[model samples]
Target: DIDVLASSEDAEKVMDHFSTLPTVVDVTGKGHTKTSVRLKGGIAVDLRVVSPEQYPYALHHFTGSKEHNTKMRHIAKSMGLKMNEYGLFSDEGNENIPCSSEEDLFKALGMTYIPPELREDMGEIEAALENKLPKLVESKDMLGIFHFHSHYSDGSNSIAELAEEVKRQGYRYMGMADHSRSAYYARGLKEEDILRQIEEIDELNSKYKDFHIFKGIESDILTDGSLDYSNDFLKNLDFVIASVHSQFRMDKESMTKRISTAMDNPHTTMLGHITGRLLLSRDGYEVDLDKILGKAAQKGTVLEINANPHRLDLDWRWVKKAKEMGIRIMINPDAHSLSEIAYTSFGIAMARKGWCEKKDVLNCLDIDAIKKFLHN
Candidate 1:
């Protein structure tokens, strides 16, 4: 449902305009203030017209999680006011209060503005009341990208092509974490292939004056809680992202232990897709995330928030816990194609949903700072 507000004289004209839209196949219902239509795509859309004064109230009421609306109404009632889709009014039949925007509404209610994304009734209201809400991370804060694939693995683009695109996108550095040897299905690179890739990266690094490409690999975690490559092989790379590509059915204890073992490796720079979940499709493997988080904190290993829409692993819900444990997060696109690289925005959303600030994200760091952290 979409709600719009117009002057009394323009109400009918607004309704008429919607009725004539080419995509609207049929007007199912029409009334003075409400109209429903079915589009050619067979989706029903409803539009509710209201007085200009009620726009903010209606927007607030409709764009809500049920609990958020309920809490808002309760706050209104406690102040001897009535709040509904129509407007906020005094209980004694006084005139409506003017609310020009969501910020105005929140101000009138004596609370700080809460972003729509944070309106999940998950302590956001209380945080707003206490003036303690975090300043969320934004896309502009990201200075580099750390986890991307190349044609050497399953990716569609070659190293140089991906680097050019990354530079075009305004990032200062790119980490090519192509699939490691054990991921045979992805054509994971052999030892010789990695050596050649490094040589290629060195050549590219010389070609670009401002952009740097970090030689990294997404090494697979073996079944017995070890990395795919030997320590000597792993140490040759700039950084390593350890992940689980198989053994999805391991028991929770074993799975947690497996990840913990990987974290214990000094060469394991970050843990990727901790849960292995595919949104709206396959469920993530079971593991004690709290235990894994604690181990990661102890080992000084970073955690990855896989940005692929299909697998937003390290789900937003755990982001707070990860932050509280002092674990730095890397919002990785896990991109296989040039277009998929823009999926980093989705990871940024998940990070914000978890109340992440600029300091909480690793890619927010500049190239020199990132190098220092990686080497440390």
Candidate 2:
């Protein structure tokens, strides 16, 4: 959903402007507080006009998880303040409290400002009230990322190209987790291909003093719950991301057990897209998430918050739960192309929304720290 906010005076202009767009099929509520523009493809873009003083209030109000906003209003009420999308007011005199930004609004309430990502009412309010909100991991905190592909698999770019792009983006390291031989549909790399890719990565690392690429692969977990490659081959790689690429219909207990067994592998470094979900397309496989988290916690296995918009697996809710269980989280773009590498931004948002701190994310570490983390 495309949501936008405009000033009250420019409401008509804003509404009229978008209505004339070539993609717009219909427009309604032309001169009202809100206008809905129906695009040719059936997506509705809603625009709401508010006063400058109301922007901050309206922004959060409109971005509601409903539960979070309601809780905020309740807190305001307890303080004898009237809170609404228009503005916060004193109940005694109905005087509007001035707020130029969201932070100001929170400060006025005597609470720490909460990021939009954490505005889901998932303990954020309570944490904010006590000034105990997590210092959520930000985009700048990511020093590197994992689970991106290369030409060795189905990716559009070569390993060197991807590594150079990652370095250009200011990352210290990146992990090349191409599809394993089992994922033949994705041009998965075979044993020989992996060997060559490892050699290439080694060569690249030697040439570039500023960057390093971890030799990694997204190994498939067979239905029997074993990883795709032998321990010897898997050990040769710097990291291995175990994932369920097929058999989404496996029952909860079986699927959970399957993933658990893979994590049990000594060479497994991380679990990719724990749910095997393709957002807006297919439901994730049935798995006991608590059990999976428990296994990961027991083994110190890192979890992937697949940053692909279509599959934000290791979902925000689970990301937070995983952190609480002392599990490390890695925001992998799961990108198959160069442009998609930026998808890590979305993963960072999800991670923050899940209350992740820099310390909780593996990529936030520097070269030495990451090397140490991976080696362990």
lDDT of each: 0.89, 0.89
CA displacement after TM-score superposition, residue 301 of candidate 2 (Å) = 0.2
Instruction: Write one digit per residue (lDDT tens) for candidate 1, span 1-376.
Output: 4444443446778888998899999999999987888888788888877777777887788777899999998999999998988888998986798888889998888899987778878888888888888899999999999888999999999998899999999999999999989999999989999999999999999988888999999999998889988998888888999999999999999998898898888899999998989998989998999899888888888999999999988898898789878899999999999999999999999999888999999999999999999988
**Residue 31 of model 2, lDDT score:** 62
Please report how far candidate 1 places residue 279 from its true position, in Å.
1.1
| lDDT digits (tens) for residues 46-133 of candidate 2 | 8788877789889878877899999999999999999999999999999999899988999988899888888888888888889999
Error of 2 at 331 (Å): 0.6
Stretches > 4 Å off in candidate 1: 1-51
Q: How close is every model to the real structure, measured as TM-score?
A: 0.90, 0.96
